[model samples]
Target: MSSKSDAKQEREIKIVGFLCNWCSYGGADTAGVCRFRQPTDLRIIRIPCTGRIDPLMIVKSLIQGADGVLVSGCHPNDCHYAVGNFYARRRMEVLKRFLPYMGFQSDRFRYTWVSASEGQIWQQVVTDFSETIHRLGPNPGLHQTVDSAPAVSWF
Candidate 1:
């Protein structure tokens, strides 16, 4: 690839990954140790558990101009915290459904399961999600609404 194309690709794609510390994060680490090829566009945030992740955090990231968001945690019934991922799944599902309603594309957000031992899975997930985000392109962000009057009065 030419330098100009490489620079354009780097600048155009940004993916934020929220990974559960006990499972998904370990999976990513294992993938790295195993020398699995992974996408460079992802920025990982290691959270204690998927249950601790608020949907608003993902939304905030999108609002701030992330092209996509990926949330990965322990497999169902395999959570180290014993059910954290279950709650996370439900919350993520709701968020996924709600994003389109709020004017964001539903495809921009994704949630999945990956165990600590599933390094290959982690690599695949990152690759696939990164590709999907690339197809979706840059997020335009939320639209601003017109207000009748300014909140603060300078006069």
Candidate 2:
């Protein structure tokens, strides 16, 4: 008989996580150092700050077949770069609402805050997001169905 983890691996799900170096990435590192048990579906990308992540980056991930996209950073008023998290929050919120119109479910995208000392919270965040991605299954991607891609440019 297969174990639970084996069963989880039966289906392939990929979640891309964009973590702010000052906080969320540190939290993930702390979680790893503490040996926290969490799902492995998430692949982390460390960014200087969430504000630096363009909304188009998330869209590109979806179009390239990422099952889910998660953006995490420091709590509001706690960003290392003053207002980076605030900027990130607004951009992500707009993207979240606009996802469905792009043929991608909004639930497959998320944004949250976490500090370096919050290892447990980070673990919970990753676990919940991973479970959500698994439920959504694989992404069909934009280029898969369309013969020609639309011109995507943001000023």
Candidate 3:
């Protein structure tokens, strides 16, 4: 019986979270302090600034079996670098366009602005993103069919 349930949950969506070191990370910490339970699917990675996020990183997450990606940072004009989030926002917009072209769904990536003081919003972001990904169904990346071919003798 436990095995069956485990099998059912084995393919659960993997939500990768990129959090800004100063604000969004603090917000997530606050959520924990308040006991705001979030989905277990999310795994957080802290970076110095949202601007440090690269399109390649997001692509690599998908390639590595992430069902979804969430990026959270300070709001406009609130970035520690003064314009980091704005730069991040523009980068995401362009990346979003290319991911779908690469066969990933648009909903697979999400971005938000969460400040250190917005603990509730941070909690809600995680909750809502989890639910949305749940509704969208499992990530197709997990279902990739590997081609098993016999090795040929090079000699």
Candidate 4:
């Protein structure tokens, strides 16, 4: 694999990852420090907690041409904020099912939990998601049609 072609591939297929600050982010950092090999397609955005992330953010990323979206947070019973991960799990599950209706592939989005000490698991999660995204290819964003077009003007 040539560097030039690899760079081009990375540019063409972008993966956005939203990670929890206290857990998932730390897990990612640990992976890096441990020198675990992972795909470079994932662009990480650290948030305080998955519970605080808006579903629209994922939608916006997909509309903006991101090939995939991966959200990782603390485990169900391990959230620093008590029930934050619970809320996130429900929201992400519904969003996953709803993505196809919005013209985005359901597999383009995924969510999971990873703790700071779980670097190997984080590496595997990222690797698997990256592979899935590579198979999906680039996202064309939401399509507008006569029926799907908005009739109301906000302004």
Query: Which prediction has the highest lDDT against the true structure?
Result: 1
Which regions of candidate 3 are displaced past 4 Å? 1-8, 142-155
Cα RMSD, each candidate: 6.6, 6.3, 6.5, 6.0
Local distance difference test, per candidate?
0.89, 0.88, 0.87, 0.88
lDDT of 1 at 110: 94
Q: Give RMSD (Å) of candidate 2 vs. truth.
A: 6.3
Give one digit per residue, the lDDT tens place, for model 2 in 66-128.
889999999999999999988888889999999898678888889999999999999999999
- Comparing 2 and 3 by TM-score, which wins? 2
Local accuracy of candidate 4 as per-residue lDDT tens digits, 1-155: 46544554655678999999999999999999999999998999999999998999998888888889999999999998999999988888889999887567889889999999999999999999998877766675656655665576789
Q: Write the candidate numbers in order of decreasing lDDT.
A: 1, 4, 2, 3
> Candidate 4: how many backbone clashes?
0
lDDT of 4 at 10: 59
What value of lDDT does candidate 3 attain over all alpha carbons? 0.87
Q: Per-residue error at 45 for model 2, in Å?
A: 0.7
Writing each residue's lDDT as its tens digit, candidate 1 over 13-59 gives 88999999999999999999999999899999999999999999999
Give the runs in model 1 whose Cα sits over 4 Å from its true position: 1-10, 144-155
